[model samples]
Target: MAAAARLFRDAADPDSVKMADIAQAAGAGKGTVFRHFSDRTGLLKALVVEETRQLREQVLHGPPPLGPGAPAEERLPALLSALLDLKLNQRALMLALERAGAGSPYLNPTYDLWHSEVAGMLSGVHGDAAADYLAHALLAAVRGDLVEHLTGQGADPDELHEGLRRLCGSVLAHRADGTV
Candidate 1:
């Protein structure tokens, strides 16, 4: 079953993942694959949900410089860098799941939970609105095209970090009172 799961994940790509290909990769007969998954959609759904959960956990609680408690400038860069890595490493899995017509798993776990967690964190750095905006912008920035552009160019992570700092700093630098 684990092997089948891995095969299903690995078989997915930007375009599609055929059941036969997944079965071949798993070294399982098609009937066995169907027996376990019932259908391709089932496998894809499980894979995407599991993957999204893992990714969200990493972003929320994984480690310093990657998860919470880091300064916004630091957190922002780490978030973007980690996302880029995910895109590169899990390119096929992410793309395949995205093409499957599912909404973001991140949003589904309760938008208010994420919004408050992220927004609360941002409020510490900026105000509530700026934090909200920044969080939204960061999410947008990490999508397919941006990740492709950054990682495809072989851009250094530190450079990316500094660049984000400069950008955020320009817009978000503040007085001690924390107003813009």
Candidate 2:
């Protein structure tokens, strides 16, 4: 699975990833590939689900500075940093998934899992409302738009961290009345 994932990641042309290529990368026969994944779409779906599961695990229970025990204020930035790293590192596979349209919808269980983890983290320090707000904020940040904008500007991960930190802090510290 990891070998297949690497092939997907390394494929220069997203449309060119082939079952025989994945089989070669996985050191398995074509029959073995069929036995395991059934088809290319099946393999892609498995990869997406596996990656989503791994990401959720990392965000929820993996080592900190980034995991659940960290303060929401701290964890939010770490989460964004991890997300940005994922975006940069896995750009090709992500693009393939988007093109294939074969995985879970954006609002599917993967997102619910993320929303719960982020909202839970935020709720720790800011209460339910603030947690919800931060959850949405983090979600918005993780989606491609903000990350793409930052990347287009040549902003490094550290720069993203600092900017997100300030944004979350400002939002969390103020009321609807515009008073600090």
Candidate 3:
């Protein structure tokens, strides 16, 4: 899988990454690759699924801000930043997953988990109703296409991170603090 991932990462076009390429890179036969993965889609999905699991584990178990211990105010921005980095870093493989018929990202366990966590956290800062909408909005902000589009148009990631920081600060602020 390492060879396949490397080839996918380096390929000019994902469609060009054949089993033979992966097999050669892995010092195995094409049959060996197919035996393990079934086909291209299987291999790609495995890569993407592994990434999702790792992200989920980190947020659920890793220390502070990203994990369980920090206040919602601190965790929310850290969560968004971490998700943004994941989307950006995994852009190519993620796009491939969509093309491989993984279907809507919204329906995936990863999305559901993130959405639930975000909404749960937001409920502490905002009320339940506002938190639901705000959580969806926050997740939307870090989506792959928008991130790609913004960065393609010269938006630096640091700028994006700061924008998220300011947005979260505003949303998570108390009602009497002029949040509305």
Best by lDDT: 3
Winner of 2 and 3 under lDDT: 3
How does model 1 score by TM-score?
A: 0.62
Residue pairs with backbone overlap in model 1: none
Q: In candidate 2, what are the lDDT values of residues 11-33, reduced to their tens digit?
A: 76656888888888878898999
Which residues of candidate 1, in runs, are more than 4 Å off? 1-13, 29-42, 48-58, 103-117, 125-130, 149-171, 174-180
User: Which 10-residue window in model 1 sums to the lowest lDDT?
Assistant: 105-114
| Full ranking by lDDT | 3, 2, 1
lDDT of each: 0.60, 0.69, 0.80
Across 65-113, the per-residue lDDT of candidate 3 in tens digits comes to: 8888888889999999998898778776665655666556675667778
Query: If both were scored by TM-score, which would come out higher, candidate 2 or candidate 3?
Result: 3
Q: TM-scores across all candidates?
A: 0.62, 0.69, 0.78
The window of 10 residues in a row where model 2 has the poorest summed lDDT is: 98-107
Residues 92-172 of candidate 1 have per-residue lDDT tens digits of 665554445544524444333445555655686677767787666755554555655686699765665566556656544
Candidate 3, 17: how far from true, in Å?
4.0
